[model samples]
Target: MCRSSQTRRACGRNDVVSTWDSLRLFSPAQYSSLPGRLMPSRPGELYPNAAHVVDYLADYEKRYDLPVQRGQRVDSVDRDGPVLRVGTDSGPWTARAVISATGTWTRPFLPAVPGRRDYRGRQLHTVQYRRPSEFAGQRVVVVGGGNSGAQIAADLAHARIDLIWVTQRPPRYLADDIDGRALFDAATARRRALDEGRTDAGGVASLGDIVAVPPVRAARDAGLLASRPMFARLNTTGVEWADGTRAEADTVIWCTGFRPALAHFAALRLRGTRGHIATVGTRAVDEPRLHLLGYGDWTGPASATLIGVGRPAREAARDIADFIRH
Candidate 1:
């Protein structure tokens, strides 16, 4: 997601520097590609960095001749009789159907813990985190057990910070050999099994949450990857456990995750009580003319990832075309 107005403008124009900028750049240096996926890295480059991803996306856009409307921030999307009206900073446009592909990166979620406000130390979501050096010499508590949390904790450990990595449960590390390709295959198989009325064998989730990337593996070997149980509550100085043990910290980095960036759809009122828009495939059940993409499995299995999004995207496109043809 764009970190600033300047970056937003550059991203709108599909500028390589700003499209995936900070989020990708700030990822650990050892971050590698999801092997066997589309968008292979340049020759001899097995581990692609943020710059490579940016260049790949830019090249893809140019090759496909994608027409990107620059500098327009979509404010709202509403129904206008037979069509959908999209209100953006630039103006408004009407379409027979609207596909909302805006992802969740912009909406960082921090859980409400007791005494959160009273805690005087700094608090930031993963989106706001740039590098390990920023927290130098401070006691940092990294929360959440997801990939970002694991990765961030690993990053901080290497920096020699006083770090306490806490999770709701012990962090699950995938097998050393497992990677994105394996995860995708497992998910596909699980989906097929469920479709055939068989027992739903867990997919990627069965493998584990955190991928054993090089950095995480290194930290694990060094015994710095051990995680503590989540704290009971926050205090002015730090976090306290249910057993009343406390650890003073200078900052808490929340990798708790994010909600979909769906505020623009408020006018459509598509979301149910759970704050999710029900979907049959990617098409909204309440509003067939509306489609949501790259949110999560509710839309399509693994649809949130680059390799996985293509299947749902193609299905959405086909469905929309068929709807228009009739």
Candidate 2:
């Protein structure tokens, strides 16, 4: 954490800056080694970096002259080569073999709160949060338990703005604590172990370790961030806690993680527990011609990350080739 004693919000409005096109891209190397089973191994920068991978995919298509479609969001699948689809603006589109890489953000898990849809305090998900300067000098509340919430709180702490880091569960690591690297290293080790057959014992131990550390204390000590319980309701002024406590904020950031964006194929019987798509070793759904990139492991660390995506993509491609040959 950058410790400039002068409180960040103390900077006048003129000092605060906002960058709209704050998007970023990741290098192939980082993507190849992303640690979380379903996360894109993004290079940490001030801006979001997945756009780089999208660009790289486009470039790969051009280099190989592969017929890759860009900006075509698939709407539905059918025998006529997969039906209609759309653009980022929800325009129409279609395809035969469909692959969903949208990951968690597109369809976030909005909890069942009575008046949540009515509260208007600039509610936005971390996915929508490109940078912190937008909320400079304003009271902000962040809700989530994972890395996203931790990182955003840290960023805001640097800005000298009042921030409340809330989660249904409590915080674990310190705000200044950079302990995710340890988990990443452990996941990497587990991957190697599975490859070497050390714990091929049905991937029982391959699960990410469940470690919990006290939240508010570390965050408070590292930075002056506050923590609280699950949200019960929200109004124009602030959020109401389950215990009847209320926290005021100008903005509420839902960092409560993501859900797979596969509602287009909800009718298909391809999902496993919790509506997640089940795959037989990364090969496309039931039709092996198409393949799943970043899903939870059917077995192994296959579902946790972009690093997981690479192996599945390769394996699926090979399987397609074999199918073509036979």
Q: Which digits, one per residue and each the tens of the lDDT, describe model 1 over residues 1-326?
A: 11112123222224434221223322222322222334654675444555676555665666666677666667888889988888876668888988887767777888989989999999998877778888888999999998888888888888798899999988898888767667777878887787789998888888898877777788988999899999989999999999999999999999998887788888888888556799988999989998898888778877876667888888999999998888
Candidate 1: regions farther than 4 A off: 1-38, 42-45
The Cα local distance difference test for each model comes to 0.76, 0.53
How large is the C-alpha RMSD of every model relative to the true structure? 4.0, 10.1
Candidate 2, which ten residues in sequence have the lowest lDDT sum?
Answer: 1-10
Task: Report the lDDT of model 2 for residue 224.
Answer: 60
Q: Which has the greatest lDDT?
A: 1
The numbered model that scores best in TM-score is 1
Runs in model 2 with CA error above 4 Å? Answer: 1-67, 80-98, 174-221, 266-269, 298-304
Worst 10 residues of 1 by lDDT: 1-10
Give the per-residue lDDT digits (tens) of candidate 2, residues 1-326.
10111111111222322211232311133433432322234454322344444444444544556553333345443333433232233444444344455444455566666667777778887667877688987889887866566666656765677888777665554223323334444555666776677964333223322222233234456656556777788866888877888877799888776666656554454667787666666554565544555545542254445455565666666776676577
